[model samples]
Each structure stands twice: as structure tokens, then as C-alpha cells.
Target: MSQMNQPDLIGIADVAAKIPAFLNKIPNLLHGLKQAYLRTPNTPTGLGMAFEKAVLRNPDGNALLFEEQRYSYAHLNAWANQIAHFYLSLGAQKGDVVAVMIENRPELIATVIGLAKIGVTIALLNTSQVGKVLAHSINLVKPFAVIAGEECRVALDEIRHELAIAAGHFHWFADQDTQTDAGQAPEGFVNLAEKIDLFPKFNPSTTGSVQGKDGLFYIYTSGTTGLPKAVIFSNGRWTLAYGTYGHVLNLNQEDVMYCTLPLYHATGMVVCWCGVIAGSSALAIRRKFSTSSFWKDVKKFDASAIGYVGELCRYLMDAPPSEQEHGHRVTKMIGNGMRPNIWDKFKARFGIKEVLELYASSEGNVGFSNVFNFDNTVGFSPTPYAIIEFDKERNEPVRDTKGHCKRVKKGETGLLIGKITRRSPFDGYTDPEKNKSVIMTDVFTKGDAYFNTGDLVRDIGFRHAQFVDRLGDTFRWKGENVSTTEVENMLTEYDKIVEAVVYGVEIPNTNGRAGMAAITLQPGSELNEQDLKQMVSTFKQCLPAYAIPVFLRIQQQVETTGTFKYQKNQLKEQAFDPQKTDERLLVLLPNATEYCELTQEIFNNIQAYQYRF
Candidate 1:
């Protein structure tokens, strides 16, 4: 074959190798398509229905595995029914919102399922939230009642006086086996576990009235930008998850999924749980993710599949190699934010057969999944979406003369927008103004509207795209855009660098913010000249001239959100100012081969924009 035809032949061979896997996914894909396109309007389709069907199909099947306890479908359904009946007795009805503040436990899952059954919207509060932040989340939803787990009792009590909930509206449930009666119920709170037995163990009548579009969950964002916004998670969206991840991933009765991710996040609450319920499978639940115990727990439960976020995988990979890592039953892994650089290493190290990296957000309407077991891509999205050119400074889509957003070329990164339609409506946040801020109207036509995802992605052809970075995370340096995620991913490839958080810092007279990175070195490692030389060499070889970070702040540790996402707002606020932080600061001047301490003179030069790249 000619040289030009040689590459074509290789590409054909790659596709041929994947033909079997693609064909295996056809049945599930067809089922998902049917659910997405042929769903009945006003039908009772949601998590409640999905759970009910699973129970009916196999009430004796294992539903949840938490610590030493194994809950069968029948037992869990009975518990959920009793909770629903108890809520109804309290005069709670459809459309009422109930605040649920709990960690990952059987009670938390049961409470959400029970509330859905009774047509009451569940506000899944972040367990890490406390004081003013917790109060804001609870008040924003205006829940009729607040249910606190024994673990969160102290947090709830700290702000009980400030809550707007009525008297007798506070409820608490026991989560710890060792919790004393006194500790179980705080002041001015009723014990839900003690009262749940008083109600009947039968499905409530309200389940009949719950429709597809009804409110199911009010999941809060990470609040990295500000106070967490309560995003609306409708029953229809839950139904879609049931079909997509459940059927498309081909989960079955024998498959057990280990989920250590927090239940407040959409990936855990909706995606992982819905798939488990739809398949009539058991879920192995952990109170929190532990790198040391992760593989042991997977082995203990004999989990065939596992759910994760990028950071979870990173934590596992960072830990010393364990004997249990390769011998586990986890053949399929699902979730989002698996970085391209670590994807292959993670799969190879853990013996994962399928890596289903996905792309989604709590408030965004668009979602992509690696259904075909593809590497380094978020996978093919069947949903209607457009990748439009975006302006970094303005933080909006670049529009043409006719005021329509222009689509980027196949290989370019751009803003991702989901077309809003009857089938794929943007549920948006509870706050109307917040929804208005993200929804763009008349984008391509006079009547068109789209949900702005506020994420930059590269179109990688064949309807697949790779997540580049968040809109605000990408910064301009030397008049060229630099993706923080891309740079951070590269930085972590070096063995000594455990974590890297990249952001932009404004220079005194620069056109845009220069790149800065706050990195955490591996234990027993030092930021010496040799290490600096290696990092500089890697950056030069792997990144563009403008994309390399100009400043480096050596943090002993990196702060992350409850979901394991790096918190950059505080670091950005502190920047490289010597007074703001005590961490060692280093700088790579223009045309410099090594990093040196950021002295007063160098700092002043950077501030005054005296040095140009």
C-alpha cells in the first residue's frame, strides 16, 4: 500500500477490532433510544417506578449491601413505604419539599426513594455543608421539613435557630449502630427511625399521581463559585438515567456495583443508583471513599462494576500497589472526569475491562457516555448538541453577523450547548434568575433556545468529544488560550507531582491573566533544582510555549470539595502573593530553563509586566 493508504489501513484495523464491542452494545443502545424518543407524556416514569418494578420482579433479590448489613428488595421497599406513609401522616403532600441532610447510608437512599414515592421533592443537602452554607441551602429550597441523620445532628443543631422550618418539622434518623438514644435525637427533633414503625408498610397512593415531569430531587452544586445552587432533577431525567446507564451499560441481576461516591452528587444519586435499580442488582455502599480500603471493599462485596470520579481513580492510583487491586471482580467502571493521561494506566493497573468515562453536570442538559468502551473520549452523544466558538474574555459564545452562535471546526475546542426541546428540556436551577443566566434564547433562529453548558470541549469526530476544561478554568496567556485541565493532566504525569491545580493570575499591565499552578508533591519529594529541570523539560515537550504555567506555588496539600473536585477559588484569590500564603513560590521567567524562587524583584517585574513571554 502507498504511504497515504497505510494510515487508512491502520484506522480500518482499529475499527475492526472494536466491531464486536460495538455490536454487543447495540441492544442496549436501541433500548435507550426507545426510552429517550418514545416515552409517554404524563406517564408515571421515575425512580419510584423503577424501584417498584425491580421489587416486583424480584422482591427476594439483594438490593443494598452496607457494611455488615444486606438489605433485600422487599425489606428496602417496606422501609421506604413506611417512611412515605409517615410523611403522609404529617400532612406532607405532592409538591412539598423535604430537606434531607445525610451521609452515604441506607437511610439516605431510603429517604430519597420514600420521598419520591410520596411525590415530595427531596432536597439532597451536601453532608459537608455546615453553618451558613448549610442554612442557605436549606432555606433556598424552602423545605417543609428537615430530616437529619444522627451523623449530621450537630450540624443541624448549630443552625436550628436560624432555620425557617416550623416547630415539629425537624426529624432525625439513626445512622450509627453505636449511637445512644440521647444522641440519636437532638433538641427539638423527632426520631424518624422510632416513628417509621408506626406507619403501614405498603405503597402510598401518592405514587399513582407522580408523573414524569414531577420534581424528584433538588441536588445542590459544589458551590465553588458561590453559595450552592439547587438544581432541579425531574422524574423524567431520572427515568432517562434508568434507561441509559442501566440498560446501556448492560447491568444485570448478578452484577453488583460498588459506589463510594457521595450520594448528593448526580453521578452517585441518579446515575449509579438508577442503573442498579433498573437492573435489579445490588449496590455496595460505602460511607466515604478510602484509598486504603477501596480494593478490599470491592473484593469483599465481589463487585462486578464500580463507579468513580476522576479524583477517586487518582487517589487509588497514587496509593501503594495493593494485592487486592488486580484480583477484584470489577470488569466495568462507570462515571465522569477520567483524565486522558491516567485513563490507560488506571485501566491497566486495576484490570478494568471497560472504562465508561462520561461527561455531565448537575444543571447541564447534555450528557455523554463512553458506551462503546472508547479511550480518552467522553464517547458518542446521541443527543442534539452544538460546539460553538467561545470568547474567553467575554465568557460567551462568539456570534456571527446574524447573532447566531458559530460552530467550531471538528478538532477545535468550543463552548458546549444543548438544544432545548420537549424531549430534552433543561430542568435548570430552582432560582429563576439562575436559570435565566444559563439559558440562551434565539441562538440560531428567532425561536431557538439552548442550555449553555459553560464547558469547553474538543470535537473529536464521529459525534465523540473530549472535555477540555471548564469555561472559567481556561485562561489566556500571551493572547493564546490555555486549558488548565490539559496542563494539570500533563503536570501529574510526572512521578513526583501528585496533584496540580492551575489557574490564572492577573498581571499589572498584561492583556490577560498569566498561568499559575498550585501543586502538591508526592510524599518524601522535594522541589529541588533537579525536579524543576524535569518538570520544565516535560512542559516544553508536552505543552505549547504559552500554555506552560508561569508561576508555581508548592502546597503541602491541595484542598478539594466533598466530591473530590479541586477547589481553585481560594487559591486564585491568594495567587502567588508572598503575604497571602506561606507556601514556597517559584517562577519560570521567559526563556528560562529552570524555576527559581520568586524574589521581591521578580515579583515586582511580573506585577509591572516588565518581562514579556
Candidate 2:
């Protein structure tokens, strides 16, 4: 028998063993969901509308807690109203895209709700973005106005000279000094914080004016492939998705959700934002995630649930096992990208009983929810979804001569694709060309259409599927895509670099995947720290910070197959530590501009969780 066929995996005995414990915990959460439903009737409009009505009904109830500030439903509604009025005052009519660049604060949440309520579209900007890429992102949305925090002034200022936007189009929300009444904006920018303080709260301008089909927000895909594509999110889309997931996963009103992921991202927006709408208080961390302080923060907020991407899980798993490891009140988690290798360990260590491992994209109309609370599978989707054989080299779905696309067999790997139609529309980016790139017309039959997910997944049969690697050249980091082709193209421009093979490596404790590059030096050229730093810094100027490769491997010649495709599997396995492989490697320490030799002590420190992110 083949090595792969040698074993049938043992069942989740420990999970089955803990069935009673899991069953006992469900009743309280179920009760909370029931209460929320009873309190507010479901309408054609999304959860935000219901949530807004609920807020009005219970004006004094706690709606959000972030940093040191506690915002009541009344306070949040007032803030949202103020912002909605501010947009209106600035001539931001219905259907106008309002770009929001901020961290995970109450304002970010308020802005999303405010924009949604006013019939204005929000373009959620990634906080980690800087320079030309940041400028490009702003231009991509072509917003009527841009609302950014004071802290992001420098980043915006750096690219301001190049932007086509007028002085009046820029609006600043001074949040650096949150304690004092929100500060005034600098010259040429409107100060929303100052405006809100003086103005009385107003009702939603779009109340009864908007419907489920109206666009609420636009989230751009991480331009790993090319320029980012704006994915239009309507009120109905998120309402259905979040409501179904909340129902299936049993997200509740009393559950305090701790979210460190940036609110701009879909994971944070969906899980944390939806939880808030479901009558739960979402706890937001303003900055990046801290693995060491994770448990402490969770305990501090008394968080019953937390959202995660792959990297967050890995970071927590890398932390030293503590006697207080499972001491928190966390019961379940709802997120994506928990690898199979670390799945059991993460659940065991964190004492998570139910992990609603989900699989969905920003543009995908279909999504899978782990309804059965399966151990490793990203459960089933009620909508139309299929796993089809893919041609990795050509980067397309494979079809037989008979014109039918081959579906993955039970327990087989294939590319996951979702059928797109009027019912399952591929609510694509703002760009028409970019939108067309991923859509497959007449895919199976004469009239069928599908959206290519660009992800390899395995069918487990019984409506469950396990996530495999991503298709094509894109890799994920911090739940964002980092294109290997883009990175490789940038690296090859360096004087010393001849060829580059960029791929993602599994870091000890990190989200998504950390980037690593294996570069072949030009003949008679030498690689040095200064040159590396200069090249990498230049790349960072053009791309987002998360897309920067942390590890560099200097090679004489890159290995390739007969067809000349770069073999990334070997490089990914080798990573960037010289001790791990024969190739010379340099590791970039956190916040460091230059790369350094990877020593055993440094490696041990990284693995032992001594270093901070």
C-alpha cells in the first residue's frame, strides 16, 4: 500500500469524551441567541438595522468597550449619527464611497455603521499600508472623502503630494488624544471629532430610504495579484452570512468577543462587528496583536469568545504553556486558517470546546460554517460550492474533453469554486477588468458561471472540507494575500539578485504565513546587509509592511523542474535559517531594517516566545 493510504486516522476520542461538557455549555449561549431574537424582529434589512433599532430601544445598554472607553448603545448611535450628519454636511450624497483609515477603535465601528446607515459606501483601508500602495488604495476606491486618524497623518501626508484629491476631500479624525475632546484637524482637512462634539445626534438619514441590496461597504482584495480590487459588500450579503454563522455557531448576546485583528479586515468586520450587532459587546485592541499579553487581555475583558486567523493561533501556540493557560472564560472561537498540524494542540491548550472554522472570501457569495463543530473541517455551506481539479501550472480549472469539470472525490484535494449567478453573485471589485479575471463563464454548462476562489481545498465528504494551500502565486499573511510573483519581481530588480523564488513559511507563532525568499545571486556578485536593507526598504515603500519578506536565503542557483517553474516546496521547507539548510540565510529581526545571521540563540528565543511582535 502507498504511504498515504497506510492509515485511517483515529476519531476525535477526547472530543467525544468531552461531549457532556460541550453540551452543558450550549444551553446558556442558545438562550442568549433566543433572547436577542425575541428582543428584535428579523427584517429584510441586515443585522446593523436590527442592531440600530435595538440600540434605540435600549439606549443605556453597553454597546462597545474598547481601550479604556465604554460606549453605550446611545453613545454609539449618537456617534454614528454625528458622523452620518458630518458626511451629509460635506456633500457626501448617497452611494458616495467614504474611505476610512483607522485602527481597531470604537470610531472604526461607528464609521462602518454610520456609513451603512447613511447609504454611503465605506472603503475600509488597511492600517499597515503606507507610501505609494496606500495612495493607490485610496485612488482605487475613488471616495468622495477620506476619513483618517491623526496617527495616520504622516502616512497620508507622505502620499498627499501625489494624490489627485482636493483639500476639501480629506477629513481627519483626531484620536491620538482621545481623552480630551477629539482634537481639531490640521489645515486643509475637516475635523470630524470636533464637529461631532458640538452637533446634536441625528437619526440615520437613510432610514427606510435604503434596502438590503444597497451597497454598504467596499473592501479591496490584498493586491497580491495586481492592483487591489474593490469587493462591494451589500447590506443583505453580510446580514445573511453573519446571521447564518451566528445561528450555526451559536454566537450569543452576553458573550464578550475579544478581537485583536484589524477591524478593516473582513474577519474582524464579520466576527467582531456581527457579534456587536447580535447584542454582544466586542472588545477591540487598537494596535497589533501581542501574543504575550493575549491571555491577560482576554481575562481582563472577561471575553467568552475570540476571533482569529491562522497567525494568531500559531502565536498563541508558541507562547510558553502556563498553569493559567486554560484559566480564562473563553468557550468558543470563530475564524479561519487554523492548520491541521496545530488544530488539536491549539484547541487543547486554549481549552476551546467549539471552533467554528470558516472558509469564505471577500468576494465569494458562498461560505462554509462548521455547524457540527467538526475538529478540522471548515464545515459545510448551504449554497452552491464545488471542489474541482485544478491545473496549478496554468493556474486554471481543469476540464475533461467531454466539457465537464472534474469534481474532487471524497477525501481528495481540488480547487474550491463557488457558482455565481443572480442568487449567488460574485459581487466583485470596483474594477470591471479585475472582476472579470476570476469569473468563469459557461464553466460547467452553457449557462453556468462560477467564481474561482484561488484556494486549494480537500473534500472530506459529508459537507465538510479541509483547507489546503492557496492556488497560484499568492500567499497569506495577517489574513492578507502576499503575491510571490510581486515579491519576486521586486527582488529581481536588485543589482545582486539574479532570480527569486518567494513562498510562505510556517513561522512558530504568526498569522497566515510569513514571507521568505530564496534568491540566486548574479554571477560574481556578493550579498551584503546594506544592499539587502536598501532593496527591502525600497520594496516596503511600494508595498504594505506585511508583504515584506522576513527571511532571505542567498543561493548560487535556484532549482527548477524541466519546465523551468521555480520549485517553492523545497525552499518553503528549508526556510531562512542557515542551520536548517545548506544555503546561507539571513533573518530580519522585528523593527530592524537590516538582516542578521540566524544564530541558534536567536532561533531558540523566537521559538521560546522571548521576542515580542
Candidate 3:
């Protein structure tokens, strides 16, 4: 028998063990299908409607768990209604945008729900953003009102003059117990919490008129490429996400989802919260993610599921093993960016039964989920998508003579494009030009459009894909394309390395950028000569010559976005320049077995086009 046809006993045993889990997915799949079919297109399917439905089903059920406080579904709904009424009284109307800058708290959730109820689109501003970025994000949306928590008062105050909104429209709410009445309304801001008492705790009639196609959220991109772009998150897309996770994941009222991700991110706000609402379950939220507090919080809340980004999982693995890490109530985790290197290890260590590793972006129409508890794959996407051939040099899709993009064969890495259809429409960014730049016209035929995902993925068969790297992140070295994600994954497998952010750096007199990695060592670990040699040896054995990073920058920590995505733009720009950064630099010169220190002399030599990479 051919090796491909031969089934090993270990593989058979693993399959047998997963039989029950696979069988359980049937009912959930059917439920998802029913929900998808029943959703009324172009009609009102706002999150407010779903929240109301969830409240009706489980009025007394715990809806939100934040720090020491817990609010029931009815309680939360009433608070949302009160806020909705207050906003309505402020003359907030349908189709109006409201910029919201709040930390991850119950108030944030309540404010979002409240705004949705009043038919006001929310520009969910990142709490971490400040000065120019903050002002730019708010100005891009042009919101009529700006609502902020006391925690973000300083940031809002800093950019208040830059914003076009009136001073009276500025609102603030107190989240801290120490906050006084005088402190609540910082200078030009109104105290939103105080005004909530004047409004009735009843559902607003305006919510009924809100349609599925209406703007729901203006979620800003991670700003990995450049400035953050405001991406539209429509009610239809939100509802679809709700159905997929709630029904397909088989969440129930008994489940308590622990969400430590930022509330501004789509994963936390839409995916995590929508699932809780869809299943009428409880949500345990935190102000921010902390590795030390993660497991403890999970155990404290008796959480049955947790949300994660790849960095969170990595942070957990890097932390010292604790008694609290094991024997937790958590059985499932739902999120994206879980690397294959840490996948099995994270699951085994944490005692998690399922990891619903998903693949989706804020604005992209294509989405995938591992519904069958599959390992190392962003499982089946029902949406119409194509893995098309791309030109690495031009950084665009490869077009045929007919001017249509061609699809890649199975197991090939290619750019992912989602078909822009009526059912799965691409509700693009706030900037129309930015939207146009990503959409490929006549992709398959004349007049057809597809939303470019800006991600390169490997078709792993069965409609599944393994994320390779971002289109911009992949760089050419020695005339061979190198995947930054793939290189970083390999580097993290080394014992001494804790984290790695791989990028390409321009080399003097070189045809293309050379591979470079900024790595953080494990606590108390040092990159000695022996360690350096071992790293080189390991890379030689595991990766192709062209794929290996030519330079290594050792850092104390890796900078990440609020959502835990690695900040590579800065790293790429400041590559190996000793004058630009204080971090230690090491370089593997052509055919060198070990990495040598990149001193000022060597740096100058490389920059002056004296050395060839």
C-alpha cells in the first residue's frame, strides 16, 4: 500500500477518541444553518433585538460579571434602556455616529448596547490610542457625540480641541468608586451617569426601525500597516457572527465566557459578547489582559470558556506553572491567531477540551472556524472565497490575460479574497478610496468584485486553511518568499526564546529585503555564544536557507497592539540600526554558522554597501 493510503494505529486511536466530540457538532451545525436561513435580510436584526430576546429568555440570569460586581440580564437591559433614552434625549438620531472610548467594563458593554438601541452607530475608539492617532480615529468617523469613561478622560481631553464635535456633546461616565460628582464631568464633558437617572428604563421604539444593513460599529484596524482605518461592522455581519458562535459552538445559559481582550476589538465586542447574548449566557470581563490574573480570574468566575489572541496564549505558556492554571472550569476557548507551535501544548497544559481557532478580520467578509475541534487549521468557511495567485514583488494579485485573478491549487499559499455578493456583502472601511484599493474588480468575470483579505493562507484541504502570513508581512530573500509567521513560529520553538517578531529589512546593494527577527528571551535567559550556535543549527535543520532570518535583534520585550498583535511596522523601519535603537543586534553573515555582534563598524559597513547579505 502507498504511504498516503496507510493509516497508522496512533492516528486511528486519535480519531476514535474524537468520535464523540465530532458527533456533538451535528446538532450545533443544524442550529447554525436554521439561524442563518431565518435571519431576515435588510430588516432590523440589530444586536439590541438579540439582547432583548436574550433578556426575555433569561431575565434573571447573570448577564455580566466585572470585577466584584454581577448584573443580571434584566438589570443590564434596564441600564441599556436608560442610557438609550438619555442619548435619545440628547437628540441622537438614526444613522448618527457616536464615538465611544471606554475600557473593558460593564459600562462599556452597557453603552454599546444602549447606543445600538437608540439606532446610533458606535465608533468604538481604542482606549490605548492618544494624541494624533486618537484624534485621527475620531475625526475619521465624524461622530456627533463623544462618550468616554473617567479612565479615558485625559486622552479625550488631550484631543478635544482637534475633534469637530460640540463641547456640549462630550460625555463622560464614572467607573471608579473614588470618582466624585465634580470629577465625573471633566471640564467640557457632561456626566452621562447622572443623566441616565432622568430617563425611563424601557426599550426604545427607534430600535425597531434599524435595519440589518445599517451601520452598527466603526471598528478601527490594528494600524499594523499605517494609520488605523475605520472599518464598518454592520448589523447583518454581527448577527451572522452571533449565529455562528452561539449556535455552532453550542453555548448555553450555564456557560460563563471570560473575555479579557479589549472591548474595542471585534473579537471581544462582537464575537465574544454576541455569543453570550445569542446563548443567553453570562460574560466575565476584565479591564485588560494580565497573564498573572488570567487563570485566577477564570477560576474565580467559574468560567466555562475563555477568549484569546495568540499573544495571550503565548504569555500564559511563558508564565510559571501554577496550581490555578490546572483544574479550572474552562473547557473551551474561542479566538484567532493561535500558532500551531503552541496549539497542542496550550490545550494540554490548560486542560482545555476545545480550541475554536478562528480566522477573520474586522472588515473582511471571509471567516473560518474550527467547528469540529480540528487541530492546526482555520476550519471550514461556508462563505464564497478564493485563494488566488499573488505577485510578491508588486504586492498584488496576479491577473490572467482576461484580467481575472486565478485560484491556487490545494496546499498552496495564496492571497484570500471573499466574493462580494448580496448575502455576504463587503461593508468596507470609512474611507471610500481605501475600500476601493482593497476590492479587486472583475476578479472572476467582468463586473464581479471580491474583497481582498490582505492575508496569505495555505489551503489545507477540506475548505480549511492554515494562516501563512499577512501579505505585507511576507518578504523576499535570496529570490525566495519568506513567511514571517512561519519563521516566528519556528523561532519560538527554541527553549530560550519567549517571543519573536519577524520582518524584512533592506540590505545595502541587495535585490530584496533580508529576513530579520526581533526576539525576546525567556526570563533570566541570555543568548550566549553556545545559545547562538544552537539557534543557527536548529534553523538550518528546520528551515530552508533562504527562509532563515539573516539578522536577530534581542529585546527586553515585544511591543504589541491593544489586542496583542505584534507591532511590526516600527520594527521593520528600525531594523538592526544600532543608532536607532538601544537593543543588542546580531547578524548571520553570508554562509556563517553562528551569529556575530552587529557593532557600529559592521552597521556602518552594511549601510555603506560594503557587505553583501
Models 1 onward score TM values of 0.77, 0.86, 0.77
Per-residue lDDT tens digits for candidate 2, residues 1-613, read 4324423221356346646655753664465444323222123465447567668666776677766787777878888887777777777776788888888777787777777777788888877777656787888777787888887777888888877777777878777644366776788788777776665586764655655676777876755554555788876676666555655545544667788887777888875567556554544454678887888888877788888888788778877887556689897788888887899888887888888889888888778877667777887676788899988767677988967788876777898889975556677777787777887777678878888888898777656678888766677886788778767776666677888888888666565678888889878888775786787677677667777788888878877656345467657666755576876777778888877777778877877757654
Q: Cα RMSD (Å) between model 2 and the true structure?
A: 4.7
Between prediction 1 and prediction 3, the one with superior lDDT is: 3
For 574-595, candidate 3 gives per-residue lDDT tens digits of 8889999888999998768999
Off by over 4 Å in 2: 1-44, 177-180, 280-284, 323-326, 393-395, 489-501, 506-512, 518-525, 554-584, 589-592, 597-613
Clashing pairs in 2: 230-429, 311-510, 311-511, 311-512
Count steric clashes of candidate 3: 0
lDDT of each: 0.80, 0.73, 0.81
> Lowest-scoring 10 consecutive residues by lDDT in candidate 1?
2-11
Most lDDT-accurate candidate: 3
Model 1, range 429-481, lDDT digits (tens) per residue? 87787788888888888999999887889886667788876656567554244
